[model samples]
Target: MDGDYVIGGVFSIHYYMHTVKHNYTTMPEPLSCTGSIDSRELRFSRTMVFAIEQINNSTELLPGIKLGYEIYDSCASVSVAVHVAFQLSGGLDPVFNTGDKCSQSGMVMAVVGESGSTPSISMLRVIGPFNIPQVSHFATCACLSDKQHYPSFFRTIPSDQFQADALAKLVKHFGWTWIGAVQSDSDYGNNGMASFLHAARKEGICVEYSESFSRTHPRSRIQRVADVIRRSTAKVVVAFTSTGDMRILLEELSRKPSPPRQWIGSESWVTDPDMLRFSFLAGAIGFGIEKSVIPGLRDFLLDLSPSKVADSPLLTMFWEEAFNCRLVKSFQ
Candidate 1:
């Protein structure tokens, strides 16, 4: 999409990256991220496009100015995010010199995402120095709220510090003195779990075990965490993890015989509608962000088709999986 000014978007449209182990012999292969598309995050990207179109059609908003976008898939990787941030924030330097520092440059007026807190932080380190504003929809780490560290960073969701306190209180209310803890090994989970642990100590709660994992963790690592949960005596488990990491852990747990225990989750995984597929998690509990209805966003998302999305391989892959059909490409 093209316009007078561009709004850069970063989303975890894919859940995992197929990590390439380099031998450092010749040239390193291109980075490849492989995973099923996240429909919810995909909707977020589409909503950005839809909103821009609406603003372009309006006479009151921005008047004669038109806005465009250059949305990138983070694939939930901090390294990939940093790469894209450079692409969006780069190119501000004048190609030719006019003996003047002033010039019309910069790829985007502002950036609209980087859903995960870790990736957001990586992106901010790159673009924040340039004073580019980055508004996140899901990055909720309490560390990001620091003005000195993240001067140009902002988020729509409440900080995990508040959620951590609330979760600790919830456990105390139930008198679950002995519990197991789990978290993603990223900025969001580490910071959130640290807060929860501090609060839990004040409440005189004792944890039996604390484990961490990520979506990119090896199968053996995921199995080890699941085994810890299975063998633990604690009847309650508090999980401060992202949706992607939680899904990977849960999928591994579901494959083997496991004990029944109470599951407490963070807002990151708790609010995901896709988690409903795990019937064992029927009693899971967690907090959620406030919800609101958008007038025509649903229609715009539902109106997608193969023909319309053919040029976009990411969208085409999603459409194929969703409709359970393959699309044939015609060659000239």
Candidate 2:
């Protein structure tokens, strides 16, 4: 009511004020009306699976859209990431003022966090129409089979079988006649330890001592692991644990000089950043995916992408969103 109101041919400020007051007491809050868009970050893993799909679709225009969906690997490792943001306000008139909106939300990535110990018995268990990406490496030693909820699962990390075999190799490399293994109490540890024991027996490797520590043992599990290492006559020890956890365990194990001139870990300790974090881990070796080894794949992706060209702005976005940061590829 900018000083202009009329009632019965007379200026009516009172009438306008009454109307405003009525509105002040009648309307709903503003947060309800503003909730429109919902976004999710689907993990496509670092590779531009989305870009590949786009290219495949574009090529279709040439009478040679021939491959349909077959030309490209539709293997997209999709996991849902959900985040919500909103604003809310309290007002006497039930009206939204200039910054009255309130919102809150969370995001979750569908990527599997550590479950990879289960054995995927066969290949091609299903021929579903939806494309599934192969998980060559898994982040955790948790057995995937126990979940029972997801049958079509794969991991990027080697299984307990692989780690067991590798641990034996490492022990042999050190020329250690006796070895010790400390594994977590969870499925990851149990399975990993069992595998190591089996492999050592098969390879004629003497496992002088083996111990298990509960991942949730309330106490310093790392200290327990260290205790096993000390009591054993083994000159080499195998530790199966997460990178961050392993660092702590190593620090504890290093507290006092002991036998086993070398400490070997599974692929869990192999990331470049993790290796560089502690100088003491300089000589640590583990099975890890060397992206450089697949420079060809990176090169091919770059060549096909006008955006990912040398010094291109898209290159930063691509790498940032893919490596470490997680791939949330939305053209927007």
Candidate 3:
């Protein structure tokens, strides 16, 4: 925490957590708290720390100026993300009343992420007027390219417009004119699916049906979407969805005996190790961003010790999940 400039970060450290009854009669309570740690997102958050450490150690980058950071968990929810944004801006509580301002001596100069586009957009509204730059590592919604609206927002990944074009071209190459589309019910999915629909129309492709679902939605709604997918005659399905959203639908599909259809994946779940467990997605193809290996990232992650990171509540949660062990405190 000793540095000239503090970089803020927001990541979806946990996946969506909800329960459903066998008959799906009653609605479950809303997600009122953060869930368990998502190991995939933990890697990205760790990489951010690694990058900052690398820069701080470099003699040429800052010339004796040390870099530090304050990272928060977004939980992949807009409400949670907004609360974290206020904390990053030095708010005393989650509530955002008028006349509130950052009173911290060393304020953050920039923020690194909120992972998904919806959470990023929510955080932008809270921090944009302050002129704090937010650089997202994974948010890819096409709407964020608007300089007038999100002037302080930036991302390392390509926009969804480019991915939509690639998906359209790939479908056309295979001579698949009729297809079905499924996307997450968030800014990323809505905007990306809209762009893909426009691109698909221009390419002379016909979409048989388009459906969307969210993690917090009722189980019956997700079941309806699954039923639509099963009844559809389209042999090709373009899924522009997050891992959490897709997992719900996949679980529903697994219950019924159905033929495997060609699935075109989005970057969100294409390389996800959890998604690969579905045998039905074996032949699925999708677009992924270029990959590069950081020199010491692997060793750094493997060397994480509980004692070294015991002070960090976030890292403590990560340690419990990663190792399935609990630590004892003196007070306890």
Candidate 4:
């Protein structure tokens, strides 16, 4: 195990179920840890683990060295992500001391994760001092591209800056000069929307209104934004938000007696199957990361066993989803 390297990962496996009444004061219940399961995000986590196993088994990669990993669910909360980042950086205590170095051998060499940019930004600040490398699989906030501020950050996906430019260009090509904008209230949505707005302004596109809301925001706030969208004269609505945020907004929009307008999506929800359920967004279009097939990923997922299920809490959740049964003894 001397040659082993541990990679840290952060993912928003679970989301908060209850409304966030007090954004700063109220602490969510512990049971909120296991909210609605996002199977697609779970698949992303599984793919990462599968890739690590494949690398360990290959003679061409790492040769005699073994790669191990520790994955944490961020729950799509910055606070949760900060705690996990500290643990990954060997700062288990509440206080972070910059003087302390990660104990050499057991220190995480790198981190791959954090599906959203908000959590990634929060984790990056904590892990940056340790000089640990963080490579994100899904984070796309343009702010993360600043090497001067976040020197240790990298990503597998393109930056939101590029996506912003592309989106602006697409709108221009369609001759849509006026539009409405909606964004999630996190770094990913905030920064990405900022970039898009800047680009759109340069393209002479006038936004009728730009509204922002968080996933944990009260239903009334979400409804207010939906009301704005319903009343806006802009025919095109550019939605820069996560699938979770969009889910809430869509629910509110579905309640309204308004007609469907042209919807422009961000990479976050364009490909999400959940969004497909909204027939109102039938003509929605957005940029997506290039799709690629993983050779044995399907078989690996299909070949899950009880032993494998025992190794991961998330896998148990997956099993429950796949087989439509509860594993708890009480349910049994």
Clashes of each: 0, 26, 0, 0
User: In model 4, which regions exceed 4 Å deviation?
Assistant: 1-3, 17-32, 91-102, 328-332
lDDT of each: 0.90, 0.42, 0.85, 0.85
Model 4 worst lDDT run, 10 consecutive residues: 91-100
The local distance difference test score of model 2 is 0.42
Residue 276 of model 3 has an lDDT of 79
Candidate rank order under TM-score: 1, 4, 3, 2
- Badly placed stretches (over 4 Å) of model 2 are 1-136, 139-150, 156-158, 214-216, 254-260, 290-332
How high is the lDDT of residue 321 in model 1?
A: 87
Instruction: For candidate 3, list the clashing residue pairs, or say none.
Output: none
> Which candidate tops TM-score?
1
lDDT of 1 by residue, 263-285 (tens): 99999898899999998898999
Model 1: runs farther than 4 Å from truth?
A: 23-26, 92-104, 329-332
- The local distance difference test score of model 4 is 0.85
